[model samples]
Target: MKDTVLNILVDLTGSDEVKKDLDVNLFETGLLDSMGTVQLLLELESECGVDAPVSEFERSEWDTPNKIIAKVEAMTNEL
Candidate 1:
């Protein structure tokens, strides 16, 4: 799941330099813009089989790889 999310973020950001263990701020790293967040949510839904609610879309949620995995795990558990 972490790999999937990381791949999506990398694709969305159009960067291959993002390290798996690096703590990245989506906005700070310019990895995601406003619209990119929506695209990411859609990708997460499709790839993770979990629908990410707008309410669940938060800065903290996209703060880092660990957070993303946690969020996806939570969303999967909710399913």
Candidate 2:
């Protein structure tokens, strides 16, 4: 799950070095913007099977790769 989220973030940011910083704030670093967030959510749904709604996506909760993985894992566990 971490790998999947990392891959999505890397693809969106076009930065291979992002993997080294798992807890980096993507938004603050300008690595992810509103448009990229939407694209990432779509990829997460299609590839990871974690269909989190856009309404529930909060920057504080899903900002980093680790946080995103935790969010998705929680969502999936609820199903």
Candidate 3:
């Protein structure tokens, strides 16, 4: 799950550094913007079976790679 989320983030951010730093603030670094977040949610749903709605997305909760992975894991577990 961690690897899958990281790959999505890396592809979204276009940075290999996302894989290197789990705690990196994707928003602050300008790696991920609002547009990227929407795309991330789509990828998460399609690739990992995580069906989190856009309305549930919160930047504070999903800023880092680890957090995003955790979110995906939590959402998937709910199913």
Candidate 4:
């Protein structure tokens, strides 16, 4: 599951560092922005069956690889 999420991040941001630095702030580094985040949510929905609405998304909650994975895990549990 983590690998799936990581691959999506890498694909969306084109950042290999996302895999190495789990705590890095993706938005701050410009690796991810609102558009990319939306795409990420779409990917998560399709790939992981975790559908999170964009309105409920907070940058802080989805700012890093680890945080994104945690958020997805939380959402997946809701399904």
Candidate 1: which pairs clash?
none
- The models' CA-based lDDT, in order, is 0.80, 0.86, 0.90, 0.89
Q: Write the per-residue lDDT of candidate 4 for residues 12-32, one digit (tens) a residue.
A: 988799999999999999999
Pairs clashing within candidate 4: none
Error of 4 at 53 (Å): 0.5
Could you give me the TM-score of model 4 versus the true structure?
0.95
Better of 1 and 2 by TM-score: 2
Candidate 1 structure quality by residue, lDDT tens digits, 1-79: 7789888888988886555545777688777788888988899989999898778788866777667778888889888
Candidates, ranked, lDDT? 3, 4, 2, 1
Per-prediction TM-score to the true structure, in the order listed: 0.84, 0.91, 0.96, 0.95
- What is the alpha-carbon lDDT for the whole of candidate 1? 0.80
For each candidate, how many residue pairs have backbone atoms clashing (under 3 Å)? 0, 0, 0, 0
lDDT of 2 by residue, 1-79 (tens): 7788788888999997569988888899888999999999899899888887889888888888788888888877887
RMSD in angstroms, all models?
A: 1.6, 1.1, 0.7, 0.8
lDDT for 71 (candidate 2): 87
The runs of at least 3 residues in candidate 1 whose Cα sits more than 4 Å from the true structure, single-residue gaps closed, are none
Cα RMSD of predicted structure 4: 0.8
Query: Where in model 2 is the C-alpha error above 4 Å?
Result: none
